[model samples]
Every structure is written in C-alpha cells, then in structure tokens.
Target: MPDNSRYSAHIGYLFNELPLESRIAAARAAGFSAIEHPAPYAVPAADMAALLREAGLPYVQFGLRSGDASRGEKGIAIFPDRRDEFRANLAEGLDYAEAVGVRMLHAMAGVLPAAEWRPEHRACYLENLGLAAEEAGKRGIRIIVEAMSPGAVPDYFLPTAASAREAIAEAGHANLGLLLDVFHTVAAGDDPVQAIHDSGETIAHVHIADHPGRHEPGSGRIDFAAVRSALDAIGYAGFIGCEYVPAGVTADGLGWLPRRA
Candidate 1:
C-alpha cells in the first residue's frame, strides 16, 4: 500500500465548503501531509505562504493560469500567437510558486480547433515548454504538463499520457516532466497502470480522481488499490494529489483515505 503520508489535498477541489484561506487548516486537520491548488492567483502569494506555514503543511504543486476562463481558453501554450501570454503566465506562476514554496508547476497546453492543429502549434508548444523548463529550473523548480481527457475538455492539445510524454521528450529538458492524472489516463481509454510504468521517473507529480464522474475515489470503477500498487512499483515517492470533486461533503467522502498510523 502507498504510504498515507504520501497524500496531499488539492484545496481547489476538496474543502470547497470553506473559503480558500481556510482550506489549508482543513487539510491539515484531515491528515493530509501537504496541500496543492489549481488556481491560487486570487490569494496573494505571501498570504498563501503564511497559511501553509501556519498549518505546518508544504505547498506541493500548482497550475499556471489557463488563459481567460471567461473566454473558454483552457490554456495558451499551444498557440503561436499567444506565446507572450504563455510566458507572462509562467512568470507569474513561478513568482507565486517561489513565494508559496511550491517546487512543481503545471503548464496547461491550450485547445485548438481540430483542423487548425498544425505543425506550427506543436513547434510552438515545444518551444514554450523548453523556455518554461529552463526558467523554472533556475529556481530548482520543475515544470509539468498534464494530458486532459477529451470528454472533459474537448480539443485539449495533449489528450493522452503518450502525447504528453512525446512532448516532454521533444522538449528535451531535464526540468520538464509529466503530471500524470489517473482520471484522465483511464477516461482516455488507456491503462493507468501502463501509464504509471511508462512515465516512471518522468512523472514529476500525480493527481487522482475516479473515472466516469471525476468524483472522489470509490465513486467510480477505477481500482485505486491497483493504482497504488502501480505507483509503488514505480517508486513514486512524491505526494499523490487528491484532485476530485466530493460526491457529498468533502470530509465525508474521505473514508477512502488510507488510515495513517
């Protein structure tokens, strides 16, 4: 079994009952070793860092802004025209991460019309990733890219672990790695176990959510035990992020959490 200590609560998904500033304490109370957030821009970096310090928890990972959500832009990395925007977002994320003690940053590859996904888009993504990795590396930070499930985000640039792996290889940066989310791997019709094995050391971080509904573990068909076994097999010592929606109350659904000794 995976170590209970190797779990972090994604406050952006869990602990929705409380305000953002309060979720850090809630996660600590729930026994999570650490905490991560998808979007922490709303909270000033110094304030967020103070909360983590007060809660005695490390801020593990966080996502860069996915462009203008109001405009339905899931990401900006894949657009040659938005390279400036992508870099600006990365700089902002890096500043926040440095302040909050986060060592891993997730960079989302934005969507594009199916027919418009040209070689230039791929080239642009590689270039942007290389730049991100190099810049983040200077701070001893790692850059991660996740493959979103098509069912959840249509036209998402990287739609499978294989694709994200390919991009990582193409980027060829030691500081760049894959952010493997089991929900996306399974929902994309790929074996999560196989993905874990394939990603191995290239996986800088992980996210967990049940398939079919993206709900908390045990609410869907995913074999979380098997998932744990695979993670162990790969020697993934990093925290596994609880990035799922609660079927009911977030704390109530935490029965799935392995008991900590």
Candidate 2:
C-alpha cells in the first residue's frame, strides 16, 4: 500500500470536473489526507473552512493572488512599481489563510518582458519577499517561493531552483523557504533528487507531476520512487501535493496512487 498520509490533493489541478466546494468532499472520498488550491477567493473562507472541517481534511497551502491572471500577469511581487498591489494581495492571502488554518503560502515572482528585464527587477523581488516573510512570520506562517519552468510560464522571474535559492539567501529571512516542484525542476534541466538534497531543510513544501506531459505520475518519465526516497533522505515530512492534469477521468487516472487497503 502506498503511504497516503503525506499526500495532498491540489484541487486546482485535480477534480476540475467539479466545483471548488464539491472538490473538498471528492478529495476526502478519494482518500486524500489534505487539499490545496491556488485561488479559492471565490469561495468564502468561512464556507471553505466549514467544508474542510466537515470533510475531515486540512487545507495545506495556496498561492498569493497572482495579479490579474486573465491579463497575463503571473504575479506582481517582482515589479518595483507594483509594491502597493503586492502588499495588498499579501494581506488578502494572509487573511484567507488565517481563516482556513493554513500556515504556508506560495509567493510567486512575477514575470517581466524579456526586453524590459533589469537588475532592478531582482532587487524589487528580494525587497518584496523580505516584506512578505516579515508579515507572514508575525502570524506564524512561512512563505515559500517556487521556480516555474519558463516553458510553462514564459518570462517568469524565478525559473530554476538555483535562482530561487539565490533569492532566498539574499532575502535572508527565517520565515522564507522553498517550494520544490519536481516537474518544474526537471523542466528547468535540474535533477530533482539533487535539488531535494541541496535544499535540505529549506524545503517547506513539495509538488509532484510527471514531466513531458505534466500528467499523472506513471504517465511520464519521472521515477516517483526515487523522488520519495530523496524526500525521505532530506527528512521532509510535509505533504506532497499532487498537482498534475489527469490523463482521463480524475478517478480513473488515480491508478498510480496506492490503495489504503
């Protein structure tokens, strides 16, 4: 039997067939121990919290509002001119997190046009990250940054584990950590096992998806057993979020998941 205790169902990706509120009960019925979503603002926090409580599952992690996703803005944290917007988004995310008992938030580094990229962008990102860490720390929350693959998220500021590590070091906040996603790590040409080893205790959370297709685990080239081993080696005890698109029906694609018996 596969260990289900540490797996979190990312409802944002999985259960797309159902509405957000219904996804909670689906995750519980599907045997997930926890659930996460990138944007649940549409569902009131109190209602979401009540759903979680009724389902007996914890809401683990969610991303800060990426500024106007419809407008192609992945995030605003890396733009010097958008400081106010970033902080407002952070405050809103924190409020929702507190309402739902979540302690981790993914702070996305916004993208920039290739021609407009400048050193000031990095400086701005570091500054915003520091502020986010400080504010989140006040509420006993830890802020995590993940490197999204350029192929998937064009012009993303932080696109590799190395870049994310450099930013974390420069930011120098105890509450700041890394959210290691195996799919992005591999897509960026870095070895996921090595990333897990190098990140060590700085890894606050983990995401899993097979590369090449970004589908369910066994549908692609990633060796999830090795991923699990590396995570174990690093003493990572947090939830491993399933953040992949299903090849078919969500439940049918779950053959890769081990049964509880």
lDDT of all predictions: 0.90, 0.90
Candidate 2 lDDT by residue in tens digits, 147-221 = 988888988988898888889999999999999999999999889999999999999999999998999998889
TM-score of each: 0.97, 0.97
What 10-residue stretch in candidate 1 is worst by lDDT? 1-10
lDDT of 1 at 72: 78
Please report, as a residue range, the 10-residue window in candidate 2 with the lowest summed lDDT: 252-261
lDDT per residue (tens digit) for residues 1-261 in model 1 = 366698899998899999999999999888788999989999999999889889999999988889888877888898898988888999999999999899999988998877888999899999999999999999989999999888888889999999999999999999998899999999899999999999999998999999889998888999989999998898888999989988888889888787767
